[model samples]
Target: MNGVHAENLGARKAKATRWGTAFLVATAISVLFLVILVLSIVSQSFGYVLVISEVDTASLARNGVALESQEAPALIETLKEGLTRRHLATLEEAKPLESRNREELLSLVMMEIVQERPARTWTLVQSVFQRKAIFDFRDSDFPDGRLYFRSWLRASLLANPQSSSALDSGLRGAAIGSLATILLTLLIAFPLGVAAAIWLEEYAADNAVNRFIQLNIYNLSGVPSIIYGMLGLAVFVRYLEPLTSGVLFGAAEKGAASGRTILSASLTLALLVLPVIIINSQEALRAIPQSLRKAGLALGATKWQTIWHHVLPASADRILTGTVLAISRALGETAPLVVVGASTFLTIDPVSPFSRFTTLPIQIYQWTSRPQGEFKNLAAAAILVLLVLLLTLNATAIILRNRFSARRRTNT
Candidate 1:
């Protein structure tokens, strides 16, 4: 009997070892996949172009000398093939760089070429990308130009807004708007959701009424974000016109009415994410043993006091974690924002609360929908930005949760 028992125990230990090894292997593979995905996106974003500039030939010639190149690169052969000496001189003499006022410069270049050579004259336009070449001069008669490679990548994050492309799309406006929206959502949703959870878990009975409320919360969580967009359109955009539009900028006009304003977007997102906070908070509150609450109450504490002193402190880590997760969700959401009428194009940085705005996801969408291959690469880069932001937020939450857990254990 002892020999048989020993054999069985050995078999069990081997099985446990096998399962542990499999688990570790699976986890490693998953991490590796995520790493590769991120690297791919980073490479694309860094490689893509974002802005194009039109150099004013007359102005540039007046300011600086345009040295002639005997041989242009093979890629620019098409441009060089049809160019007359005068056009080439004009191209060389044009301003080598102009960062802002791209549209005006492009128009000026096109008009100058048209006036000088009534016949088709190819004009050289410069492009900026991030990390790579500073200027890419395209040989074209049309005013159209695109920023490619490294300069574009950097510009996408630094640029304010542009007429033509996502390369002109900068993170400055989107990033700030996103940060403000997230902060507002957290301020509005976290406390309210958590308070409701506390009330439901600590005070409310598990009666039909509470069950009904719980059911509704779950349902609301599942409701399509478009519905919430519609809600914002009705209440915030229409009825609360003063709050949404008039209060900030005298009502939704040409640049308004899309409900694309940051405040509207933020409030709409808050509604979308509120249920998540509430649900997670309730679960966390429930996890704290009832005995702990009873112990505090038994010691002559009121219900609110028991919760404030004992229950809440114990569940603090989980509550914080839930809030962070909700924020992460809000960060990536594009559909609701689109439904709310986020502009795919905007040059001015959103200043007043009611001004139109765009986000990273919308930017990516604009890029991908474009016919150019380079734009697709820009989209990939935008995705990488979002992923990094989400990962950073989540990592911070994990660290905070760990710290809280450690402190709670020490106190106990």
Candidate 2:
């Protein structure tokens, strides 16, 4: 009997070792892929561009003098010389070109008068390794164009709005739309999901109706997001146009009757992530030991009181963890928002939930689908922004969850 037990113990140890090795190998592979993905994205977010102007700066420079070295008055005169009367009027409409400082005037001269555009581009890797070759190519093929390094990802990109020109475009509107959508999605979904879970887990009887509801929620959680988008189209956009479009509140845009608004998109995403939230919240509630509830009741506390005071606090961290997952999905979702009428090129920031909106993911998709190489680089930069936003949101939730767990432990 002792010999047989020793052999069995050895076999179990071997199995455990295999499983441990497999787990480590899987984790390493996941981390490796994630690093590679991030590196690949960063690679495309910056590079060198041959920015040639329609009116070459070389000519504007006069006898090999750099245009940039010229005084503000000279630059202003250059602009007056180069720009049309209509162009001068348009520039004056924004700000008096005569009153503008040197730097501003210089930029205006290059971008507006000179009409500097990306003549050719090179990736960061190529820009670094083939620096001489790239310079030679630019000198030979596009001698008039200036070769300069440009980082697509810029702080200005966050502040500026989308534009027809890729150089002038930014993710400000999309980022705002995304922030508003996620905030609304969390507001609408979290309470409803937690309430539903609380009722199902704590109050509902063990019967077919409840079981069916639970099973359906699990199934719904796995449904394609696009289906939810279609559902939103039919239900929110079409049937309940007044509310989603904010007409019910006496606020509506010109085409809001179609119900394609930020509120509608948020509602659609809320619906998309609702089941996941419900199921995960239910799981969290289920994991709470019955003894806590029984002890609270045994101390003469009401059922609602017991749950509000004890059960919820016990499961708060896990509920929040699940919420992180749900919101992550919501933040990254594009299809549903597209179906619900997200504008691809919204230049202005969303004024309200009723206004037209677009998210980073939609912006990325639109830019990526374009034929322009610069837009592709912009798309890559947007992807990085989206990833950072998602990570920041997730980290905030995790920090909150950790604090809850710590407080609960300290209280105990």
Candidate 3:
């Protein structure tokens, strides 16, 4: 009997060890997958492209006169002299060189004067592993073309406006629009969500009506975000057109007839994230010690004063964590904004809440839909930018949370 019992116990221990190993293997696999995904995106964002120019740089830089050293007027003259009449006319029609500053003229000289266009592109892996193949292919197919490895995510890519051409396109307008929309969303959602959470968790009676309201809030958090977009379209875009379009404020631009603007998008995203913020904040408020609230009331403080001075300060960090989650969800959301009429091809930055706009997600979707290979690389680069923006926003929120937490500790 002792021998049989000992063998059974040994078998059970071996089984438990197998399960632990399996769990660790699963976690490692998940981490490996994430690493591969990020590396793939980075690889696509940098590489070698076979670029051919309408005019050679060496030809333009003859007589020891480099194009970069020239003044605005001289750069304009050089551009005109180097570029064909048709190309020069196109550049002038796009934006007058005469009105542009020295920096702008220099960029135009490099871009338009040289007229660089990608003939063929290679991913980072191909550029690094098959450098000889890339150069040979460029030399054989297009002798005039140059094979250069370039990082697509340059400062100019963030500075310049969107263009039809992949080489000339940038994220300035989309980035600005994203920031404006997110700011508006936060302004609208955070206070309202937090206030609702405080009332529900601290002040509201545990009655049937309040319980029903809590249930609905939980349900809303699970509803599809695109449904919120549709709701925003029906309400903010149509019913509140005059308000959202800035017509009521007398700030509407001429010919800007539609209510499909950044304000509507922001409001739509706010609605989408409101339930998340409220639920998370309720949990945070509930997490505060009941003893602290009792102590404030024991000191002859009213319920409102107790909450404002004690409970809120204690729960500020967790409340900010909810805000961070809400912002993250809103940042990556494209469907709701799309339904509320985000532009896929906006070139101009949004001047106000009522202006037409596009976010980075919309920009990435637009680029990925294109047939061009280069645009896919651009889309990958845009994804990286979107990730960076989300991280920056979360980092800022975390810093604020930590500051409040420190203050609370010092006060206590």
Candidate 4:
């Protein structure tokens, strides 16, 4: 009997070993796939640098090559006058190719020289440690030998709206518009959501009114965002256009009903995400221990005071996590913004609440759909930027959550 029992234990150990091996193999495969995906995106977006150079007309004549009319000397002179001394030096040091050989030269330069500037560096005695910068080449693919990478990135951020030309692809207007919309959305949604949640969870009796409202909140969260876009069009732009005249525009400016301004879009998004924030806050509030509430009551504290001091403070971490997540979702949304009449191009930065706006996601969408291969790369780089922002926000939330948990443990 003892021998049989030992045989069964040995079989169980063997089975566990096999499962562990399988798990490790699966993890390895998943990691390998992720690496391959990243490499593929990098190769498609950044590996190619488009080149359009003016051949040296004299040299072309000497070499019996057909002249393409453009003068290299004039272009070079203009570039030298415009660019800084260091930039000109860098351009001069970049090995040149006759116009025909530009593609090959550009490939070589990108492979060897392109690098981003790091944020920080540390030195200990004679040694230095530095964090290498990661370039979003996939987003800003400047023409080889034509413009410096840093110049191109700055141009994208600074340029005003232009036609469907690469020269016009700047983030100035869109960036400002996005900032305004998000600020408005936060202002409108945060209060409405938090208040709704507080009312539903704390004050409202468990009855039909609460049930109906709770169900509708969940339903609203699931409603297609474009529907809210339509609502904003009818309600804010048409029905309440009188009140918004001063708010949407001043004496020199004009506002339209076609969903052109930041306020309209923000209201649309506020309605879209309000349900999510409400649900999350309610859940967080519900999770707080009833014992804390009872103790507050035992101390002769009012219901509002108990809720404010004990319940909210305890659930603050979760509420913050939900807010961060909702904002992240709002940041990535493009379809509703598109439906609400976000422009594909803008040159000027939005200066006020009534002004126009564009977002990173919308910018990325515009770039990706364009025929120019460079735009596609730009879209990829923008995607990476958005991903990094989301990661940073989530990391902050995680740190806060950990700190809250630690404090709670210490208090207990």
Candidate 5:
């Protein structure tokens, strides 16, 4: 009997050892792939490009000092002199050209007037190791072209607006549209989802109808996002066009369509994330100890009062963990927004919730689908911007979660 017992214990120990080794290997593989992805994105974001403006850059220079070195006012004057009246008016309509800073005006001058475009490009690795070879090839093959070390990721990418030329394009419009859409989605979805979760976790009786609803909620979370886009197209865009388009409120702008505004897009995203929030919130609420409720009841607190004051505060951090996940998913979603009518080539910023919109994901998609190497570089830079924005939002949520955890600890 002693020998058999010892053998059983040894077998259990061997199994545990195998499982631990497997888990460690899995974790190592995940980290390795993550590092590889980061390296690949960084490789595309910095390099050397052969830039050749159609017009000689020095011809536009102020007293041979260079056009790029000019002041804002001078650059604006140059734009006025070089651009057509219609083109000038289009630029002014977005923002008063005079109000733009020096660098922006310079970009405009280079893009619109000089027509500077990337003629050829090389990756950072090639640019560094094959410097002599690249220069020799450039001089022999295309003497008119000039070489410059260009970092695709730059301050200008964030500050400037979208453009027909990849060199002049920026993510300002898409970023602003993303912020507006995501914030509004949270406002519309968070409360409703939490309320549904509370009902399901605290009040709903286990019955056929309730079980059906629970099953549907779980299933909805896994549905393709594009389905929500179709639902929004039918309901918000077509059926309730007047409301979503702001026609009912008499707030529609000159060119507002039946729908397809940020409001419609946000509503679609809200539906897409609703199940995720509810499931997470329900789990959070469930984790709170039953004794807390009993204690509240013993103190003569009503069920509603206990839930609002005690139960919710205890689970706030966990609930916010779900919110962070939903927000991250919404930030990177492209197909739903595309199907819901996100403008693919928009330059002007959305002025209101009822305005047409786009997002970082959409911009990245469009840029990547193009045939140019420069556009691919731009796409890589946009991915970095999206990652930074996601991290910033997640950091903010984490701080709030920590505060809630601290407050809950103090209360207990």
Candidate 6:
């Protein structure tokens, strides 16, 4: 009997070891894939490009009057004098350069007068390995083209607005729009989600109606986000146009032609994230010991007071964890934003909740859709920015959560 038991134990130990090895292998594979994805995006964001200029800076400065040397007013006058009426009108229509500052005017002069275009682009690997080939190609195909190694992710890319020319395009408007929409989404979703979760977990009776509501909330969390977009379109955009468009507040601007504004998109994302928040909050609340609730009640505390002073503080860290997950999901959401009418190209930053907007994901999607290789590089850089934004948000939330958790521990 002892020999037979020993053989069985050996078999079980071997099986457990095999399973543990498999799990480690799976985890390693996931990490490897993530590293590859990040490397690929980084590679596309920095490299060598052959830039061809239609007008040389030397030619523009032949009269010893460089555009950069002039003040804003003089630069504006030079732009008007040097450019044809049609070209000047086009520049103004794109964005009014006259009202802009000296630095902006200088950039515009370079963009319009110099007319620099990327003649050829090389990825990081190609730029490193085929340096001679890149120079030879530029020399043969574009003798006048200058080859320069440029990092696409720069301050100008983050500061300027979107442009038809990728060289002049930036993510400032999109970044602002994204931040505004996410802010609105969090404000709308967090309190409501937490309140609903608290009620469902601590207050609501275990009746058929309550059970059905719980079931539906769980089901809704798994629903396609685009469906929420459609619902948002019908309810927020069409039905509540006056409210969402700020028409009710008498703040609707002339440019806001419809209800497809930042408010509408934010409400859509709020709805999209609500279910997840509620479900996660409920789980967090449920994890608390039942004895804590009984102790508060036994001490003659009101149910609301007990919950407010005890239960919520105990679960605040987990609640924030849920919020972080919900926000991360909302930040990367593109389908619903697209369906709800996020603009693909907007040069102006969102001035209010009622203004038209675009997000980082939408901007990346639009850039990737374009045929130009330069746009693809721009898209990669935008992806890097989006990742950084997400990390920053998550880091801030984590810090708050940890602080709350430490306080709770100290108080106990």
TM values, all candidates = 0.70, 0.86, 0.90, 0.67, 0.94, 0.95
User: Clash number for model 5?
Assistant: 0
Tens digits of per-residue lDDT for model 3, 115-216: 777888889998999999888888789998877888998887888888887888899999999899999999999999999999999889999999999999
lDDT of 4 by residue, 1-412 (tens): 9999999999999999999999999999999998887654544333323243333334433234333333454334434444578865654553332442433332222222221121211122111121122123323543233322222333443344433444334555666676678779989998898888989998999999889989999998899877887887777656765443334344213433344667777888898889999999999999988899999999999999999888887888888788778877887788888877777775455666566567778887888897765565556556666677779878888888888878877877
Candidates, ranked, TM-score: 6, 5, 3, 2, 1, 4
TM-score of 3: 0.90
lDDT of each: 0.67, 0.88, 0.88, 0.64, 0.90, 0.91
* lDDT by residue for model 2 (285-375), tens: 8999999999999999999999999999999999999998889989999889888889998766887988888899999999999888888
Root mean square deviation (Cα) for candidate 2: 3.9
- Select the stronger candidate by TM-score from 5 and 6: 6
Clashes of each: 11, 0, 0, 7, 0, 0
Worst 10 residues of 4 by lDDT: 120-129
Could you tell me which 10 consecutive residues in candidate 5 have the lowest summed lDDT? 249-258
lDDT of 6 by residue, 72-127 (tens): 88778768878999988877886787678888888787787788888878889899
Give me the displacement of residue 270 in model 2, in angstroms: 0.6
lDDT, residue 380, model 3: 90
Q: In model 1, which runs have C-alpha deviations exceeding 4 angstroms?
A: 1-36, 48-59, 63-152, 162-168, 247-254, 257-259
Off by over 4 Å in 6: 67-70, 84-98
